[model samples]
Target: MKKVILGLSALCMVAFTSCKEDASSKINSENVAAAAERDATSGDFPTITFEETEHDFGTIVNGTPVETKFKYKNTGNSPLVVSNIKSTCGCTVPSDWNREPLAPGESAEFTVKFNGKGKGAVTKSITLTTNTEKGSEVVKIKSFVEADPNAPAKTPAKPVIKQVQ
Candidate 1:
């Protein structure tokens, strides 16, 4: 009779332990799924990564138009969408990029135009809006412009034929 009671107690303990393990496993699974969902919808959807960070336009003569292009890839797993782009000054113009939802393997370009009206070293920036965690991005375009000094002397050394005889 005592043996029978001991055997039944052992079986009950085993069954209870198994049930507790299963319940804990379910809870852990739920937590994992919740974490994944939170990561996905945390408003940090995609990323915009560029191949080149800095661009130099070299030297441009005054009153000329100079432009440069920036290439980039959507390095993240999700699609990258670029919204609005703004230039820091009126002398700098950024061509609008109408392409949307750049896939993980795709690429894009942003063209920046700088009017060589200003003298000395010019530094400008273009701001981009997107669905990234940072919400926006900025790219810099720079150049050195100098006024042309030889543009005014055309007929100075034409003919000095007066006292040759």
Candidate 2:
């Protein structure tokens, strides 16, 4: 589906981009898998790597639904387990995840669908519970929703005039 392709594209981008400092900072599938083997021989070491932690939905029409994907990979040696994903509130909801134990170098994505029913600047966060060192990670989504132009407007009623015969 579209979501699958988008996730794959994100994975590819992360694999291709250059890291700024540590090798972990720039995780590629090739190195991640290699490290996984080393970890298996040594001990269990699970790490989570997100291609991008934040997503901006920009401007959206009021009462409309907007969405985006937060892509991640297990760069650790052990299988990465995502226990749960909690959203800040109902306005933003996580639609899907791979669910199974994510093997090292294997990629997955969490898709969030946001309802822009309230007209104003909106920000939401998703808390991911994983078996990583920190045990949790936060991903953010933001947007500015414009008023719905097609919404019906209220009009004042005309005053009744009294006639005297």
- Per-residue lDDT of model 2, residues 74-139, tens digit only: 999889999899898998899688779999999999899998866688888899999887889999
Off by over 4 Å in 2: 1-44, 154-165
C-alpha positional error of residue 6 in candidate 1 after TM-score superposition, expressed in Å: 68
- lDDT per residue (tens digit) for residues 9-127 in model 1: 99999987776455555577778999999887786467788877667887888878888888888877778888888888999888858557888878899888888777899888888
* Cα-lDDT of candidate 2: 0.88
Candidate 1: C-alpha lDDT: 0.82
Off by over 4 Å in 1: 1-40, 151-165
Please state every model's RMSD to the true fold in angstroms. Answer: 16.5, 21.6
Q: Per-candidate TM vs. native?
A: 0.64, 0.65
Judged by lDDT, which candidate is best?
Answer: 2
lDDT of 2 at 146: 91
